[model samples]
Target: MLRSLSLLALIAASPVVAEGARELSAHEHGVGELNIAVAGSDLVIELHAPGADIVGFEHAAESDADKAAVEAALAVLGDLSSVIALPAAAECSVSAAEAELHIEGAHEDHDDHDEHEAHGHDDHHDDHKEHDDHKDHDDHAHEDHKDHDAHDHDEHDHAEEAGGHSEFEASYTLTCAAPDQIETLDFAYFGQFENARELHVQIASDAGAQAFDVERDAAALDVKGLF
Candidate 1:
């Protein structure tokens, strides 16, 4: 399967792909993406979106309700039997599943936080060196003015605490008995996630690769010969 970023780059070059990405990304709280790969008789689908689009809030879970919402969304995404409705002739069954939630309870949250902090520290160290060089050159005025942007430090901290526009990626792999019969995806995400009004879908298969734009009104995409 093509990597999601690579797929984005491949499809983004086209007018339709660019338009779809631009339109979907315009949503302050309404965009998401889906990557579908049909290899042999296996089907793999990945979905990603901003945390606010998934759980209704991008910040840390401060209440039981907040946590529950995130959990519920993840659960729905994990259930292959529900999030999609394949044609009866296809006979696709879930094989493996995984989801990444950078929110409070996720195991990856701690590691990601550590990496983020390290990156911030590296920037601070660089800034400190720059300030020292300026001091040696008698440029105290510039150094003093730099503090004006110091307020952004607080915002950055808040972002770290809230997971900053938190995003989730759910991956599902399925084994299909009748790959030839599979042509369309009845993605339930449109109905499932109201806040996520638009999606950009990319499909790669033996025939070739294509991109599709999904909106609230039209949640399904025609994928004839894609497999």
Candidate 2:
């Protein structure tokens, strides 16, 4: 099995399609995928997985609670140096790092509904006022009810409105002083994401391409021939 893994890794290191530029998703929930490529002194890595795998849930973030989680995830993914350790001799620095998170239904009909509802609320603002001549009572209950209904609707929309799955993909690039000397790569992604148990990695470079698996407990991989 190790022999096959090495062979596949070598094969994957060769030039393929523009796929290396695109995000490649994983096949399962707890499993994630990482793709790394070396081009001269520049190294590009991409990680893709279900949103739940990275952030613990795939539903649209409606509450204030999810922002902290999102920021923490982005912080971890944004700093490649933190998640993956590199050789000091290589003198690698993350020139560019970014993360993209997508909720399956966040911007679809749900958004349209939100827009339509926004215009609706604007035109009906006066209807919410109820006046009693004797006591001059102002009833804002209808407006309050609409606000409550919208919240409920949003929660429901995120739950069942989307098709397929929600996933996040992050890309980070590194510039190395000695790119050739950087022969190995290590990841602490497992430590960052508690639910992610396994990682599938694809590697391609000037030398060749390879494919391999990295379990959480074993979080290191070789990139000897990457460039």
Candidate 3:
């Protein structure tokens, strides 16, 4: 298996891919990025796509339906043959495959946020406890509770409006018996993920580097002599 970082570093050396990397980094909906690197008899591919294009939603999987969609998408992504087909003469077989979904939100920082909230709650409780009269303390606490509830409701509304951003990433490493026999890479990714409409591909090989823009209508990357 090729080291992912090394493979990406070699691909990044391609001037076209390097220059366009910034534009490809944008999390544009319906657009996906693919990087291909061929070294000796090994071929490595990395795919990056917005969660919206993969699962129809870019938020955390909170509901059963959302979770199911994420699972299905991952399954499809993990299947290397479902995404790209190599020339049968090349005799390529996937040696490694990985796929994952990531949601951008407070989820990753939940522990820190929870700690802060707990500290603030303790402070508020102590302040209420210091009151001389028990009934006065109860009434004040009740009002404060209502205020907190209202604040939380406003936050929830804002979060809903902002929605959530997520993405899917997959990587594959394949070994080919006859790498030079590869004439093209037929992408079936667009058909598998209905929301994926465009694929920006970058290729790096001993022959040099090249780039191609593939649309759903034409999803083949010609690599007749690249290897």
Candidate 4:
């Protein structure tokens, strides 16, 4: 099956794709997005949101508490009933669902930190050996060495400040016995996550394509006639 991003590319070919892309890229803290497509009895929905909206922060889930929060959010996103409510009359069941926290630049930042530590350790060892060999010269360079260490510490702080922020992505596939019976999609997401204030929705189906800005106050999408 196509991944949600690939599916997004497919939707991008449609007329409303530009607006959808713009909304997602804006990355407003309390805003989220949903892309829905219906074809026959198959329904696909992709959800995207800033990490802050789901987990209270956008940094990588490094600490145990942060990691736990990410897992909890993923669990909720993966469960269809927890995040969405479809028409019961449609007799729909989930076929597949996936959720992930995408930490931008995390791997690159991790690799850089590892490499810096290794090089720093080796350099320190080399300096120690040189000091033993040339005690007099090393004593004279002690002040310069302190200055270099201070510079390195400042650079490390800057690197930490540039740590990556995260976002959540979820995709779901459902099969309905009666496609035409689907009239509305009620989102329980706002109740699950109080931080989520708005959902920018785009839908494509047999009837046509349409867009909506669903707010926390009105969390349901009127999907009548889409099938």
Candidate 5:
């Protein structure tokens, strides 16, 4: 009976080892899909896992100077126990999409007062006479001022009632496949914004599970201000 129990324990342990091996292999190959975008000065990267846990990550900068900075940043990330270093030659491709910006404000029309002032000057008047004429012009200007003020107020109220606002939308797709799955999954990150200030992302499938991971990197890269 002791021998049989030992055999069962060994069988149970075999699967664990096999799973670890598979995970290691996956890590070595890295992710199947990668997407990147630039908003403002921030860089946003989204990696997808079709069925495997992301055990490692590697990034190469486009330039030598950027490479040094990227390497330094990776070093800081590697210090964390939760992260695993990826192979430099891992097979991964990144595609970036253009970012969208939207701004909204109340529109108004203003009369050309400068032109009116320029034409109203009289060459024959002395300084005192000009001052008196200006006072008289000011007195007449008040005649329709109340109606113009009310018109502006009404336009502002209409703008407020209409709830004028702007919205921006951006979409990026990543194709990643798992060893167990025969087909690749198209993971999408759709970002929406009411203004240029804040962003909301809607992820497809189980992508939300990895939101924290992406958010952490985004924050570190200062991508939050891109929206």
Candidate 6:
């Protein structure tokens, strides 16, 4: 009977040994979209913004256990705040969304490039014919070639500037996996003057499922009606 009791005690403690420290899911009010995901000791935060804005957040940890604690905390974040204090084992990824206007602009540019290339080929052929007709007038041919070179440089500059715009929409999706466990979280935030952003997060285990919502501040950043 003693041996049996000992075996039962060992079985009860097995789960605690298999599962490390519990961690919390938390949220804070802020000027932009903030998404987080954690698996075991790994945590990732994705920040979405327009025009390459800076992000900051203040994080506090009471103990090493807090490093692995699953408790959710909430606070308001500002431009200068440090978002979160992450453990050395944590990993993060950041990305910016392509602005719709910019994408349209790029497509228009590609079309313009096609048109320009066609026109350039035609002009090159015309220049060849004119060169043959005026073989003795090498100076005029040189001037025409210089003008064509300048036109090519102007087109290249316009293409480079259109590609360099920093304005963009931002969105993020994160995946976390543990032994026999996996979870995924996804969120997006668009910077509109008076719209609402929506966040949907989920966690799943063999035991059950959990869902949570990060509310949007209309006055902060809006992502509504942007299909």
User: How many residue pairs clash in all the candidates, one count each?
Assistant: 1, 10, 0, 0, 0, 13
Q: Write the per-residue lDDT of candidate 4 for residues 6-78, one digit (tens) a residue.
A: 8887777777654432222356789888898999999999898888899998865568898678768987987
Candidate 1 stretches with Cα past 4 Å from truth are 1-28, 103-158, 161-163
Record all residue pairs in model 3 with backbone atoms less than 3 Å apart, i.e. clashing. none
At residue 97, give the lDDT of candidate 4.
78
Cα lDDT of model 6 by residue, 108-227, tens digit: 335544433333333444575677686554665555565555544553454354442321222233332331222222222323222334334333333344545544432122212110
lDDT of each candidate versus the true structure: 0.65, 0.67, 0.73, 0.72, 0.29, 0.34
Q: Better model by TM-score, 3 or 6?
A: 3
Residue pairs clashing, model 5: none
**How far is each candidate from the true structure, as Cα RMSD in Å?**
15.2, 14.2, 15.9, 16.0, 26.9, 24.7
Positional deviation of residue 144's Cα in model 2 after best superposition, in angstroms: 29
- Can you give the lDDT of residue 43 in candidate 3? 92
User: How many residue-pair clashes does candidate 6 contain?
Assistant: 13
Best by lDDT: 3
TM-score of 3: 0.64
- Better candidate number, 4 or 5, judged by lDDT: 4
On the 0 to 100 scale, the lDDT of residue 173 in model 5 is 27
* Candidate 2 Cα outliers beyond 4 Å, as residue runs: 1-27, 105-159
lDDT of 3 at 132: 31
